[model samples]
Target chain A: MTKHKIRKLPLFTLIFFLLLFMAGVISGEPSRVLEQSRQICLSCIGIG
Target chain B: MELARKWVQIVIGFLTNGYWAFPFTRTIYQGPLKVVCSPGLNCYSCPASTTYCPIGAIQQLIAGIRFNLGLGQYYLGWYVLGCIGVVGGFLGRMVCGWACPFGFVQEIIHKIPGPKFKIPRILRYVKYIILSVMVILLPLLAVNEFDMGDPWFCKYVCPAGTLEAGLPMLVIQPDLRAAIGHLFFNKLAILIFFVVWSIMASRPFCRVACPLGAFYALFSRVRLVRLRLNREKCTDCGACHQVCPMGVKFNESPNDAECITCMACMERACKYGAISLEVGGLPLHSSPLRKTTKS
Candidate 1:
């Protein structure tokens, strides 16, 4: 594709999604939260 | 051209674990591995990464609150920033161009067949925004009275952590699967984004997103290393621009903030030898020329 012809996707879309993801984390209902139960902090040698 | 090719080869070899210098037995014992610099910036987290990454060390420092800088006699924070600045002042983003392991991975991923895309020009500024928010703003805000701030980049975004540190540890310990949570997915998504975007664009993250790159870019103009243009030497042929993978226009200026000083343009297009690595006011050139016309 020609450089000039490349459609400029809206920046807002990217921001909106990022903000939404952050909000989910703050709200404590992360849509795709990974279970942190089993992971150990290598430094601490304790489960995170 | 030959020198440039050799330099590129050396860079690739260093980055790709191409080891052949040692004898057979030592080579096997030492392995074809790059040594991980401890308490240094090399990400110890990457699986294919034989070397420890510096960012990871910084994050670990913050996480552990290891302020005994003198005891270890290793000041990682200062050392990392100093290394970056020294290298950047001399070579600009040559580290990103050649030595960065993550850059290597991104280049490989970008080679995949797909509908590649470039972030809109306006959106290119988002990397700075990310640097502000993720690296500076968040870390500053997260700091407690104890002066400990979360390593926001590692916590929120760094794909290197996920690929190098997270996935490997998870793979080793199957029991950790149950603990997987939203953070993992969040980082995974970021990794996927860069991986997919790289296919169409070259080092999108370094060009636009990397805060570290942004810092080095600021010094590109006056840093000991520079690209000089001879206005009188000739035509405004757009050869340099054509060769720059980052889409920098050379005729307009040589030391643009975006210019990585990869020397691809200088090595390939500058028929006049106008551009040369300069330290202080001296040009590292044997031949001197009289003043020429201005561009």
Candidate 2:
């Protein structure tokens, strides 16, 4: 890779890292998901 | 690189759905870790899933909005959507090729001895329809008298939920046996159909049915992590196209919606080093830098 192209790596890496951090901070805990999943969701199971 | 990708797919699958010890437990993992979304098509209802399925979570939020639309009791699943958007915006469908368990299952099935088939190009749009209708619109608009909406995608579709969660639950919970009805049979039928089809075609679900894949494909043109082709270096030899399991015509469109970024096309397929896995134009995986000497 040329030096000009090589310089672009850090920008992409930074964006990727920031996206991960943002996703972690934005999402809520699993309790809600667990509650939904634990039940035999009528819709998901095709009973609805 | 193919073997390495398969290993990554398997490892990520196991890690994302890692409650293997309690494989019979229909109850999802309620730990703090479950708050995070793994970038794949893993079902949250899977007995072994530690992280929540973003797609399922989004559907639930949409369904719940019917009763609480104006009552200030509704949340729009901003977090879940954000998780999906961030990942999709960066990696596109690379997750499908290297991380999704369902995709891995399809890949393995295609290896079975069978006459392969090619899906028509027009059929690729079906997944986008599934994403918009079954996943989004149906959940929001199909409320009943109780103001409850069905997760239409998961209910009538989603073989992942069926194979990972429904089948296991039926086996372990004796009481659930009585509840086995036509609906269960229908879901089983869908799963069987996909499984058999995968044996004869590559990633039929990903290409034609996966809402999550459709969502990610939207970002293919602008994703930070993607396959880049140096047009000047390309000879139109079609070697890269030959190895592409998704049948992406990289010569015409390197960042097409159908490109999965599996790197099969990048790993020595281009004799001129035209194709490479790049992070914003910087080559991450490609042929080694050519040796140059000062004149």
Candidate 3:
């Protein structure tokens, strides 16, 4: 690709991911992450 | 700018870990804010952590993808990946320099005067491998009898988890000590090893082993906001090389993957002011010495 196109890619990627992120939120992924993280995270603490 | 950067890191450190009532409550903060993702690597399991670590959340989602799909769930952590992509696309590794609590801890540990060593350049690729295998592939593909996969990176590795979550949790609840075994010892050893190594080398973990860093690096070539270098103004004095904590040779490669946008070179090293923080081709902070020179 051209230099200009390459430069524009991150912005495009950002918008795309932002939309994807909103989709994730609508799908209740954040709630799931919240639920998992709210606990003691047994494996993270190295106990599980 | 170094002093200013230090203060910023310290403030962000506290802001991200704002749940100080963990000691009084004897548990992590489980408020509604937990759904939001912090840009840097702050362990959610850390009692004071108010936000989720992007890497950890990604691994958790990926690990459970198969099981979740079986249960007819459709989400695949688009939010987490989007969070990562947004930051990485905008600022590259600047988050490590100015926001990461774990990176601040590493910098603090490295402050103690000691003999320093250079990390092997080849080792820079290791984080990418870890990101691919340990963080993504293993969590997605490695399954148990129940068809559920573990967050392998958190389970077997991740010294940050040991420092931010494992040790603190153990301190908070002594009852957890009973379950401690080889895993705890292994993680402890890893943490201690990184602590000592950080003193010897600047950001050994960030440079070599951080999967999050690896992921952000993908956007290095295209990050919208970053430190820009003017080859015309640069004398190629190799000054940026000497001052750079991450060993980035800014002259040779302006937007190197490992360049954390720390501005060490621009702050104190370069006198000509060839480097400046920029966004969308506009100068945000330009040459301190020669700001008057027309661009």
Q: TM-score for each prediction?
A: 0.65, 0.88, 0.95
CAPRI quality level assigned to candidate 3 from its DockQ score: medium
lDDT by residue (tens digit), candidate 1, A1-48: 212121122223334434543443454321111111112233221113
lDDT of 2 by residue, B215-259 (tens): 889878767788888876777878787888888888888879998
Question: Any runs in candidate 2 off by more than 4 Å, and if so which?
Answer: A1-34, A37-42, B23-26, B288-295
Tens digits of per-residue lDDT for model 3 on B101-173?
8898999999999999999889999999999999999988999876688888888888888888898888898
lDDT for B148 in candidate 2 is 71
Candidate 1 has what TM-score? Answer: 0.65
Candidate 3: pairs in clash: none
Worst 10 residues of 1 chain B by lDDT: B22-31
> How well does candidate 2 reproduce the true complex, by DockQ?
0.28
Candidate 1 per-residue C-alpha lDDT over B1-295 given as tens digits, one digit per residue, 9 for 90 to 100: 4366446645653554333332232211122232223211233433333443444433444332333332442322433344344555555555566555666677677768888665455655666776567765665456665555666776777775676557765665667667777777877788788777788887787777776666656566545555566555637767777767566787687767777656677777666655665444455541133344335
Model 3 off-target regions past 4 Å? A1-7, B290-295
* Candidate achieving higher TM-score, 1 or 2: 2
Among incorrect, acceptable, medium and high, the docking class of model 2 is acceptable
DockQ of each: 0.02, 0.28, 0.55
Q: Identify the leading candidate in terms of lDDT.
A: 3
